[model samples]
Target: MRIALGVSYLGTAYQGWQSQPGGKTVQDRLERALATFADVPTIATLCAGRTDAGVHGLNQVVHFDAPVERAMNSWVRGTNRYLPDDIAVQWALPVPATFHARNSARSRRYAYVLLESPVRPSVETGRVGWVFRPLALEPMQRAAHHLLGEHDFTSFRAAQCQALSPVKHLHRIDIGRRGPYWRFDFEANAFLHHMIRNIMGCLIAVGQGLRPPDWVAAVRDARNREIAAPTFAPDGLYFLGPVYDADLGLPRHTPAFDWLPL
Candidate 1:
């Protein structure tokens, strides 16, 4: 049976989600834990999206076909026992033969939390992105409007990205501010390497009055990565996870959902 797992992790100490040679990634730790719990020599898993180092995952979906049989509850509880404090299996389910953690996802969502204050982050140092300059929400909103729809996002893509197409459909973007903190919510068909972080950099630039709102559109049309702002810090980026159809019987949220902005 194909087992689907909802995972959450603080990527501060890890090298993102994909497994690496050094075994210092979230996938490495997860595979190890799964293998130990199932009494298997190795267990391979695939993620819905690959996050950069220092990024977080709120409810990352993953799937694997295990040779041994185990109860769903045991997969969660037992696997988590072998995992680190910052990483956990939130939920487990037996998915249909066609259900894929990545391919079956209809949409992927992400959120970036920012601290806008004169003082740098203290308690949430590695948890939130910090910008000492005050930001204007109006310009940021104006800039976001231009990015809603299918377009070539090469201007915001990382050079190392292996995506076949630079064009992607950005379904929605919501910029919200509460007190000194700013939250940016995004939903899309998919995102390229550094796509959201690069967009954050441009949005922050426009918000800080360094560039005009139309600058975002100009950069998008330019289709040049060098013309856009630098990629923003990965600290604040969080993979809220993927959305599936109701018939799939997948849980869309984890316990950490309440701790973040709705």
Candidate 2:
């Protein structure tokens, strides 16, 4: 039987989502725990997206095929029992054999946070966001508007990105401010490696008067990585959620939702 698992994890302690040669990873731990529950030595899993080190996921999806003997509820409880506190299995359900956590996803959303106060955040140092300088939210919002559509995001992608092409349809890009923090929300069909972080860095530069608003479009047209800003820290980023089509039987949207202004 095929099963789809919804997972949430604190990526601060692990290397990344994929298993590494000698490093601990969320996948390695998850495979080990799943083995214990399945009573098997090998279990392969696929994720909706690969999050870098120190990044977090509020609702990451993974799919795997295992025997029907393992109940959905038992899989959740059993997996949690063996996994560390930082990672938890939120829910598990039987899925169609054709369902996939990655390929089947319709859209992916991500949020990048920034604290715009002089004092650093103590509570969410590595969890929330942190920025010590005053940021002009209006300009940042304006700059983000230029990115809301299909474009080749080569400038915002890492040089080592393995994606076959830089073309992607960016559905939306939003910027908002709440008291001492600024938030950036993005939705797209898919993302390239370090795409969001690099975009955020460019927008921050625009916010700080370090870059012109037109620079965003210029970079896209150039399709050159050398002209783009540095990638932002992974700590302030989150895999907010993924969107699936109604036919998938999964919820169409995440319940804890807030629609950011476009």
Candidate 3:
């Protein structure tokens, strides 16, 4: 049977979502747990999105073909038993063979949480990004407007990015703040590697009055990675997961979603 799973994890301890030779990645740990639970040598799984080290996932979706029969709830509870405390399987259900965790996704969402203060973060270290200077929301919001719609995002794309194209359709970018916390939400058909982090670096520059809001347009138009701001730290980035058609009967949110600070 083809089974789909909703997974969540604190990425601070792992080497990212993809499996690596060191076996310290989230994929390695998850596949090991699956093998142990199903009494198989291994069960390869594919995720809806891959996050870098220090990033987090509120509802990362994955799917695999089960090697044996088991209740859906058992898949969740049993597999999690072998996993580390920071990673877990939230929910599971049967899906059509045609359903792909990555390809079938209509769009994806991400959020960056930043703490604006002179003092660096302590308790929230590795979970939130920090800015030493005060940031104005209006300038960042105005700078974000230039990123809306389809455009070549090569300026923000990492040199190692393997995406086939530099163009992506950015659906929306919403910036909001409460107290000293700033949240930037991005929805897009897809994102280039390091795209959001690079953009964040520029927005933060604009927010701190280091660059004017209109400067973002020039960077986008330039399409040269050298001209854009440097990539920001990945600590505050969260993969909010993928959106699928309603007919697929997938769960949109998990308890972890509520745990994030608004």
Candidate 4:
């Protein structure tokens, strides 16, 4: 039988979402817990997206197939029993054999956080974002406008990105302010490696008056990473969630909105 699981994790402790040799990872813990509980030698799990180290996820989806006929609640409780406190299984349900966690995802949403304060943030949000000089929110919003449509994000992509093409369609990009902090929201069908953090870093430069609003457009046209701003820290990034078709038996509403800045 095929089962789909909804998961949430604080990524501060793990290397990343994928399994790595000799490195602690979310996948490694999940696989071990599932194997021990299900008594299966091999279990294949698929995630909606891959988040870099120190990045977090509020609603991550994973699917795997097993021969056990246990109830959904059993899967959740059983998995959580052996998993660490940082990783929790929120829900589990039977899914069609054809369902896929990654391929069937229609879109992904992410948020980058920035805190403007002379002092560092408290321990609660310390791992969530950068606490830097006050940034001009209006200029940052205006600069983000340049990235709304489809374009080659070569300037924002990591040099190590293995994606076949740099071209991607950015469905939405919006910047909003709350108090002294700034929030950047983005939605796209797919993202290139380090794309969101790199974009945020460039916008931060613009907000700080180090770069003009037109700098983003110029960098995009130049298609050169050297001319673009540096990539922001991964701590501020969160894999908001993935949008999947309802007909595929996935949850209709993602958990992303719960963490949205009011």
Score each candidate by Cα lDDT.
Answer: 0.94, 0.84, 0.94, 0.83
Candidate RMSDs in Å, in order, are 0.7, 2.4, 0.7, 1.7
Model 3: how far residue 114 lies from native, Å:
0.4
Tell me the spans in candidate 1 whose CA falls farther than 4 Å from its real position.
none
Clashing pairs in 2: none
Q: How far in Å is the alpha carbon of 235 misplaced in model 1?
A: 0.6
- Runs in model 3 deviating more than 4 A are none
lDDT of 2 by residue, 4-73 (tens): 8888888889888888986499988888888887888878999998888888877888999985477789
Clashes of each: 0, 0, 0, 0
lDDT: which is higher, 2 or 4?
A: 2
lDDT per residue as tens, model 3, 1-262? 9999999999999888999999999989999999999999989999998888778998999999999999999999999999999999999999999999999999999999999999999999998999999998898999999999999999999999999999999999999888898999999999989999999999999999999999999999999999999899999999999999999999989997887778
Give the per-residue lDDT digits (tens) of candidate 1, residues 39-65: 989999988988999999999999999
Better of 3 and 4 by lDDT: 3
Clashing pairs in 4: none
Error of 4 at 48 (Å): 1.0
Q: lDDT score, residue 103, model 3? A: 98
Winner by lDDT between candidate 3 and candidate 2: 3
TM-score of each: 0.99, 0.94, 0.99, 0.94
